[model samples]
Target: MTEPRFHGPDFAALEASDPEIAGIVLDELDRQRGGLQLIASENLTSPAGLAAQGSVLTNKYAEGYPGARYYGGCEVVDRAETIAIERAKALFGADHVNVQPHSGASANLAVYAAFAQPGDSVLAMSLPHGGHLTHGATVNFSGRWFTAVPYHVRKDTELIDYDEVRELALVHRPRIIVAGATAYSRELDFAAFRAIADEVGAILWVDAAHFIGLVAGKAIPSPVPYADVVSATTHKVLRGPRGGMLMCRAEHARAVDKAVFPFGQGGPMMHTIAAKAVAFGEAQTESYARYAAQVVANARTLSTSLVDAGMRAVSGGTDTHLILFDLQHLRIDGRTAEARCAAAGITLNKNAIPFDPAPPAVASGIRVGSAAVTTQGFDAEDMNAVGSLVARAVRAEAGTADGDRELAAVKDEVTTLVARKPAYPVI
Candidate 1:
């Protein structure tokens, strides 16, 4: 008989080699199992995605695109990437797709490089007002290398004022206009953005990182029809491995692909691309549409419950899977609320509300998401209970004796509720 073939490094072997890391991984798994994950940008990947991400493809180094790699042994990875590119094109109805970006930020940077020269003016949403860091934050490359002009939501209505967007574009005359948000709960007006960009002769770029999955499932309108280029992360509501993708008109395909390869990053991560293929295929199924619809419904239910518990939800309610609440009325800050909720086995992030008075570290808002919990099978009734728990925890004092008791009590309830549902039942 032939000698037994060596497959790959198994977790069992890893435990023997490095027990410390193995133990930490197990601890993290347990923590995820026992707590409520409400982070708006997080979701559990499917088993197929996980397996693909950890496959033998990780050992390969394909330095270039599928057919024109700088290294050898790329034939198999080339096929995997071709599948990913084709599926992304079908899913988004785009003329071209680039699957080499490492993250959403990288994708945005590539788009900027493709369309605008260094120091050219670019307009995007304000970071404190729901925009992402890559969208012209002062410390980011997009801000440093370009003339970054930011717009904000109206303080009175807590919504994007399209008229103001047009005015800003007319005044600034930016080379590119970016329309997307990280914390805003309303649906974006992509057509309006396109019109404004046209008035200014600017390229409209939509970073739909948070809602690509919803668009794929037809739960929300797509930006592909209006945007000149669109960038998105695969890991959020898309529920894929951690990676990024770019879709654009066929005319700009060469520039975008070149920017991602030689300009923004080195070799593409083939393993992640394979995982993305798995996710894109999964998104084409009927069940994903149901999941997407349920995510939106869960968000609305959670926002309503929070309002019922006397907390003020930003924009009154959500039209997406995210809910941003102003913590000012609760007599607490975002940092305190985040800590208290975490103490009670709930995980979320502090955010800045429109016209927030406090600093970023101690902002006057808390943002919660329903995607992860919905993935774990949470529905409207469960969201009501979660909202109650959040309210109670935020209302509790951090350093007081009674506060400790209230937090402990809420933690017990959260543990009991979450224990009933597993995020990955088959795992």
Candidate 2:
């Protein structure tokens, strides 16, 4: 009989030590390989990046910035952090970069720590109008601590109203004017935002968590030049680890660094920092630029295809990787649509459309994204087919035999499609 292999750095060893957890890991791999991932804020990180995240650096606890550590034995981790900061600075064209924040929300918290007091006013897009919760939802710390001033998209246009934003800024004179969104599908006018912020003497902080990856790839206009500070995620379109990063102008460098280190968080996650460095290096490649361009193209194609399949594309269509679909025409709620898509081997999420009639729990919109599929080597034509499949899935009436047949058919077709270009193609 073969001896139990309880050793390091191998799946066999993990299986021998803990079969239950190992089986779960393998099952998740199988699920990812077998299905379509269309979550707007999600992406498939490279194996190299994953290796860095799973590296021995995880054992080290680097508590401060490079070269200035609270922990004694952080010399090696410091080097990894310095590399990450330099690469992020180069990628985003910012004078300062902090790769310490654990998530985009953490990065935003650091920004608030750096720039404003608890009672200061914060002007950001309203959550129901395509903004992130960190922007100032009532339940979030941002809204609870600060005087939250919300803005909205135009009723007819279904797009951000610059005039309204300017008006709000002028009236509120918020300490920080946030310019970014979580679900909005249009490119932001960072220059316009800068002008507004300057007019009101408010700090222009862009929450680029959803679209920073495209900026890194040079596929979209960067807010780095216009905003006073930009907080972003290393994942999503950026295709790094599940981490947060902040970039800012030179004037705020010290404040930003202090905010990330001693204020917002305690110790730096050195392994994730190293993984972010790997991702930033990869983003500098020409292939990444091409991938970014394809992402937008696929999104536009997918939105158009969904429109053809009787869904109303919010804002007439998308100019970015995300597409928000209003499902009022079909009379199906976003929750139901999300479940239907999942049953058909496609994954997406329920979202609220601008001025949605239904509550958030049963929102009126479904959000789709192209970044993951594009990373999986899917193209415009593939997105078109995906749109058709999504439409069929959403229209199927669950709990009925006809709906079951339709779901089975869609699942079979999805299985065939994903097989052609499986995620993590090697294994």
Candidate 3:
């Protein structure tokens, strides 16, 4: 458990003996092991997943699906990918599974390629209204290829308005209807979205990248049954390798496979896929279901605690694993809050709230999430304490003279909180 600069060999020795890459890698590993990662899209993979990811399987190049690969030495990689695909299908209850895309955005792009051509219409959540870049942000490749028609939440409610979505569907009649979000709080109404898609002759594609682990735990409804295809990242709540997968009906299996293989990428990352299989297998257990439920409960507790601390949370609270706190309500800047929080040993991201008054980089809100802390074994009560410390820090910065002193106290509180919760247990 000794740090690199301590017990580990010198950088020059590693660079010469292994590769210059070894030095870069070990440095990153040191940073990750020491820092607090609160980003909602990130997680600590299990030991089994990590071991697979760091295995010699990475040396293999598996060009196709199991048993039908173009490569000569793909026998073991075939098993790894086949296991990953099967576990994904079983966990989500889908007829087909393709565990090849390198990232969530890639998975989404494959979905678009399978269903729509360039300039075809797509109904997706608005970016400012809790949408992802791939969902149709003008700067993204998805928007570059397709004309994106977006739906937003009610201005007053700060949550998705199904009535508005239905109206948009009626007017646009898009080729695909996407249901999922990056920042929105309340649970999505997948059934309502399915109905809208049916009326408009559109295919329902659910991107449950953020909440797949929750669905496995039964904390939320799974979209596999309601959608034509589902795309997700295995790393988030699923706690796997940094990769993506596609699940869909049997009819689209061939198209999905082609889209992910020859269409989206070349030889798959067999090592990561091997790691994903381990992660998916872990998700199939009773313990992982309990872990998934703990993620949501911790999120709610964090959201409620922030509200009590006088910060305005989007949709008033959270039903999933993330919460957006409006820092402007406390007369603070999201950028400043982010920097101060990190200095205080608390970690999270600065995110744009629905209809945020500020720009993207310097948003009006900070998003705090529970997935990482929950993985570290912090539960609801721990989140309550964490939330109060955040409120105190924000309020302190808003004041004069004594503010910096109070920030010190907040830092100590965070140190104590982590001491009680601790980081991930060593393998």
Candidate 4:
């Protein structure tokens, strides 16, 4: 609360002798807490999840899966992990679930290790066109270890072309087909993907990391029905800790479990697993469903507002929690917009629009989402203003020297708005 005190009493005393480094860390935390977090891949967890994450469970070493441990004092950790896995399986209707992958990418790696060998062909969505890095970007380990073939969306529509995906799958005949993405703005046709995987006898791995909460709330069709393997992060829309989980059919449970344990990783972080269970329990409520629905509504509202302001929103609008705005078309690069917004205390990420001409450092797009803002109780009206502020700033950034002054005013207004809506309330 107090700028996330980087040093405790003792450490503070030690650093008090020379407060420069400690002062810098404190300033950084103040900056983070002061800014509005609009990054789609991020979320603040519930108090219960936070409690579990910082609990005594961190003391134990649970080397193997539940019911099998390499050390003592893991009985409680086993229960925690079991509850997490069971709740997740029930939530997604999966035959098996593993709550130990350190991250979503690791979960994907475990699936690959379970189902295929090194250098095996794997099909995934293209990075620039809305695929995750783990789904075989050139710089990622997936592309290095496996033959990663990527498919993209239609250029004009900026939506996934099922026909193109099928054509690529058929031509590639991959060992595994990965569905889902990091920055796409439309609902995925999991059944269509299932059919393509079926035709090639390839396993379907769905990375529901970005939309697990919406899927759990039934706001979007759950990918579990069509996917052979599912990997997701505990945070994002899931509103849990920063970790990943994996689920699969019972037939592949042992293989997947082994791959995650001795093969992919060892000694699970029990505290994170405990946090996952807590968040999963929270995801089962009726209120969460309504929250999920509002997420979509807010996205649509925000996207519509931006488009009306003369910004091009890819695919016309969104069916999920994110909206990708092509800033290049507005004569503003994403990098400049991101800096300008950050100076105004708005914290969103710059991204590449599908098949963008710009480089990663200076992207052609800016992705805005409403999850964190919605958590702060901002509704459609707030999104409209937020959208307008964003659009104006980006446009002004192109040629005006007064963008900095205007952004500073926006930052003061945002801080005043945030002061009225507290993230945590007295329960």
In order, candidate lDDTs are: 0.92, 0.93, 0.85, 0.85
List pairs with backbone clashes in candidate 1. none
**Candidate 4, which segments miss by more than 4 Å at Cα?**
1-29, 398-401, 425-427
Best by lDDT: 2
Q: Give one digit per residue, the lDDT tens place, for model 2 in 318-349.
A: 88899999999899999999999999999999
Greater-lDDT candidate between 1 and 2: 2
TM-score of each: 0.97, 0.98, 0.92, 0.92
Task: Report the lDDT tens digits of candidate 1 across residue range 101-126.
Answer: 99988899899889999899999999
Model 4 RMSD in angstroms: 4.1
| Model 2 lowest lDDT segment of ten | 3-12
lDDT by residue for model 4 (336-373), tens: 88888877788888999888999989999999887777
lDDT of 2 at 66: 86
> 1 or 4, which is superior by lDDT?
1
What lDDT is reached at residue 418 by model 2?
90
